[model samples]
Target: MEDLDVVAWIQVSDGRMLAVRSRGRDLLYLPGGKREPGEDDWSALSREVREELDLELDEATFRELGVVRAPAHDQPRHAHVRMACFTAAYRGAMAATGEVDEYRYVGRRERHLLAPAAQAALDLADRHGLLA
Candidate 1:
């Protein structure tokens, strides 16, 4: 059994949170990714958001949302994911780049469109009153 650790950005707007589909992937996920070796959560999330969304997160605006755990999507049955999540203000327009294929805002009714980890993040955001 392996645990896949990642850092995620939980950006919500107009009752929806930002989600993305990586190239060649079907499930939509939060705009973040796995942390690189020796990288802390802030740096990892910032780097991932920059790579996937083409924007830079403001360190000053960083806020801890919470962490979530779930079965790793599209991975082995025993694989699991532990996602450290946060919210932050960012600079520049957000557009799909790097591994990202499409980016959009999704609400609860659209939950089925996301990966397990992302679904967990969405629920966490809703609990924090960040979503409608």
Candidate 2:
């Protein structure tokens, strides 16, 4: 089986959590991406969030939320993804950039619209009282 190791930044406000849709993709995903070969969690997550959302994550403020695994989005059934998630303060307003085409804050009712990994993250956040 193939495994995709990636990082995600979990940003929730009010009752909604941040989600992004990549260009030409239908499902919304948590805001982060795959780590490069040599990058640690903070470095990789910060870079990915910056590239996708145009926000600078404060490395000093990062708090490890949790890790979640699920079948990989848009991949074969034998593939899976392991997402290392964190929450942190960020600088600047977030806007879609690069491969990101759109973004929205979604709640539990919208879980069906998210990719599997994102849905798992959402459930975890809700269980931890991170959601409204």
Worst 10 residues of 2 by lDDT: 71-80
**Top candidate by TM-score:** 1
Clashing pairs in 1: none
**Residue 7 lDDT in model 1?**
90
Q: How close is each model in CA RMSD to the real structure?
A: 1.2, 1.2
Candidate models: Cα lDDT each: 0.92, 0.91
lDDT of 1 at 83: 91
Give one digit per residue, the lDDT tens place, for model 2 in 35-129: 88899999999999999999999978999999999988786654889999899999998889999999999999999999999999998899879
> What is candidate 2's TM-score against the reference?
0.95
Q: What digit string (tens of lDDT, one per residue) describes model 1 on residues 1-132?
A: 868888999999998999999988889988888788899999999999998998999999999999999989876644888999999999999899998999999999999999999999999999999998
Model 1: weakest 10-residue lDDT segment is 73-82
